[model samples]
Target: MQSKSGTQKIIMHIDMDAFFASVEKALNPVLQNKAVIVIGAQTRSVVACPSYEARALGVHTAMPVYQAKGIAPNATFIHGNFGKYRTFSEAFFEILYNYSELIEPRSLDEAYIDVSHLVTSMKAAHALAKEIQNTIQKQLHLSVSIGIASNKVCAKVASDLRKPGGITIVHPGQEKCFLSELPVEYLPGIGKRTKEILNQLNIFHIEQIANMPEKLLIEAFGRTGSAIRAFASGEDFRNVEKPEESKSVSRSKTLEEDTLNTHLIHAEVFRLLEECSLQLRQEKRNCDTVAVTVRFSDFYTISKQKKLNFTSNIEKELWPTTTTLLQKAMHIHKPIRMLGVTLENLYKTSQISLFDYPFSKVKNIQQAIDKIRKYFGFEAIQTGRTFQKV
Candidate 1:
């Protein structure tokens, strides 16, 4: 039974409670009610996720594993498994898909959903959220927190209002009231530098941010200031974009040690690019922007991107531009600790001119490679360059 009411946006932000750690518990009943922390690939890597039990002991995600150990000394540390999590994520999103297809996944465990058409009243929305939350809890043995609001920002903020299996709703026109008391940092897009600027002005709350003179804020912060003011007023016009509706596909790795070896650095960059390009091909997408990044030992990172005249996912087609960007990124005095390859400005693949002989040959080669990989596995075909010694 739907109650027809005022026409306004209704968005829900659903976040799984301690997604990775929760999945660990779901897999092993013996681990329940105990502090658990998931570690990333490298032994020295940071905490990928911490269970509520671990969080209660002051362990947090992204805290160094060493520091987290100090905080939760008796916590069980499990190595994170992306494949297992991906399976759970698929099931999790499938449940959400049962409710609506207008879903935007923010990460592996969180997403935004627009239910404006299905439920016309706040009460109905809350009921639906509870149903969804309960379904996940009963079926998957996982806790979820949800926020119901008129827009994504408020909903995201509200979703955080309560923890593990809680719901907070901000009725239409109550966005300001709901956000007034929260710290200015709670607003999306308000990062460290912005917080510093706002703090300098003694602007620490949403109310203070909302009350700041528009012109003065604009003069002080430029174009971003206006956005800050609007966000403070709880104004968000962003829509819930479908998960595949994206501008880029990127992958990066932090190396185990800092090195300046050309062979080692270039090899890592190409491997990352190979992964990014494979994703592009799988999506049947092509890109105009090819970029490379290098993070030095000191953590000072730099990137350079090349905009091509045409779009492509063909590795050979992207090779030259990517090499140029990599060269531009690696010309630093500091040893490189991290590298990334990103493809941007993506769209569905389109026909290429037949006269482009090299692209045609390479494209044919890649298509053949993709077919073989599809039937066998990605490991069945390998680029000779990927085997180059460091």
Candidate 2:
């Protein structure tokens, strides 16, 4: 379809079919064609992903494992292995990189690719989509659903229409007609609450939303209403953005059990800080802002941040700021359920201060520590502060 500039744009959205479960089935032959549900290791973990078979039986992602077990009693429940899934995800993107450099990863399993430069017509786009599907199926033994449209919004909605190895295409100038008959929920950003409000207004289909008065929609949803109305009409001007470098680094952990012990909480926060610092140094980035987050047992979360005059990736240099932020954030005398450390306002690392020899020495020590941890594991070396138990 031609954009407003009179240039043809073809956007493709690819979503894997039950990604985590599909990966499990691909790796273990025994899981093929059987109902599979992937869950986390925590005792109170929920289903991470459920196969189509399990979904047919009413199981879904984020449903409690116990509830899923009751619904799909005979399904095979497996603990999720993120490392294995990441390896497959890397391979998935590697294949997409060969098709187009203008790719935006929505998640580990889904991405948006702009193939406007490669294909000349809708037929060519269909052929390219089929080729991509075949390549992924042949290489990964997994299925994907693709939606091809003039823009990202319609493409994402179309991709979900026919799932599990299906390709749906919306020809140029047919975006509104293609989406008109679909439910209002098919439009992006329409969640349960929004659907309830829409239902109250007797708006069940995308066509109703498209025909609504702009002032009424704005009144109903504030500024977001305009965007929702545009999406319902299959109008989205957003481009497929290339992946950008991370602006911040963070590490968080849910404690085994909530506790009021300040020592243990401090230790956990320090451990997370260590991880974030290590990641920053590895990326050759420095952050001038440090933030701490604490989640109470009641699920009440609070965060505090402090900005420093200088940026550094060394844990020792960042710890004082992190500690002060943590102390400020943990003022509520409640048992802590989780701890997180964040480093922000990042920039490429610059030359170290020549006059600050003490800071230079500490940086050298941290680099040595990073190399040792890279060869050995992170647990091979631990500071006294991180040695405490929860």
Candidate 3:
């Protein structure tokens, strides 16, 4: 589609088909065409990804494993291996990098690539999309669905319309027509609550949203209403942004069993803190904010954050704040199901200051420990605070 600047903008959104399950199938030929469901490490973990075969039987991502089992009794359930999936993801992006530099990664399994400068016509864009799909399939042994359109929003919508190696294209000047008959939920940023509200207004399709008065929508959704209407009318002007450095690092884990034991919960939080700190140090970054999140057995989640006086990647420097945030977040007094730690406001680590001299020795010791872990393993050394029995 031609932009206001009179230049054609061709954006392609590529989404991997059941990425985790597909990777597992690629690793084992026997899993091909089988109903596979990948779950998390925890006993009460939910489905991380379900293959099309399992999905056909009503199994879906985020559904509890037990419920998925009830729906697809014959499905093969496997614990997801993030490390292996990351390896494949790196290869996937490497191939995309060869096609265009203007790529925005939505997740490990999906990305939007701006190919405006490469393809001159709709035919050329279609050919390029197919080429990318074939390249990924041939190299990674995994299928991908692609969507080509003038903007990111429409492209994302088009990509989901097809699955398992399908390409859907919305040519320039056809964005509104392409979205009209689709459900309102097809538009980005329209969540379950918003869909319910729209349904209450008898607005079921994109065409209804596109035709609704801006004033009434504004009265209902406030300032965001106008943006929703614009998207519904296929008037998105957002560009495919280039990838940026991570602004935060976080680690979370679901417990083997829900517990009210404060000590055990503290131990899990500390373990997550250590993991986040280690990651920060490895990235040569430091965070000025520490946050803790607690999830109760009833699925109620709360988070608390505190800003530090100085940026630090050391576990010792950040632990005090992390603990404080955890205590504040756990005020609900319910059985905790998961614990998470987040280190935010990240920046490249600077040279230590004179004011930090008191912790310089500690930093050296921590660096030495990091070196040991690098050569040996993370479990080779454990702090006393992180050791506890459930």
Candidate 3, RMSD to the unseen true structure: 5.0
Clashing pairs in 3: none
lDDT tens digits, residue span 148-207, model 2 = 999999999989999889999999899999999999888989999999999999999999
Say which prediction, candidate 1 or candidate 2, comes out ahead on lDDT: 2
All candidates' TM-scores? 0.70, 0.78, 0.77
Supply every candidate's count of residue pairs whose N, Cα or C atoms clash at under 3 angstroms.
0, 0, 0
lDDT of 3 by residue, 277-312 (tens): 888887788888898999999999998998888888
Q: Report how far residue 275 has shifted in candidate 3, in Å.
A: 4.7
Candidate 2: clashing pairs of residues: none
TM-score of 1: 0.70
Q: Candidate 1, residues 1-390: lDDT per residue as tens digits?
A: 112354677899999999999988997989999999999966659999999899989988789999998988899999886656755776799899999998999888999999988888899999999999999988888999999998888999998889988999998888988899999889988888888988998989998998889998899889888988888898888888885567998889888778887888877788778778877887788888998888999999999998888888877668789989988887777898888999999988764522246556776788888777654445567787777634
Off by over 4 Å in 3: 1-5, 260-337, 349-390
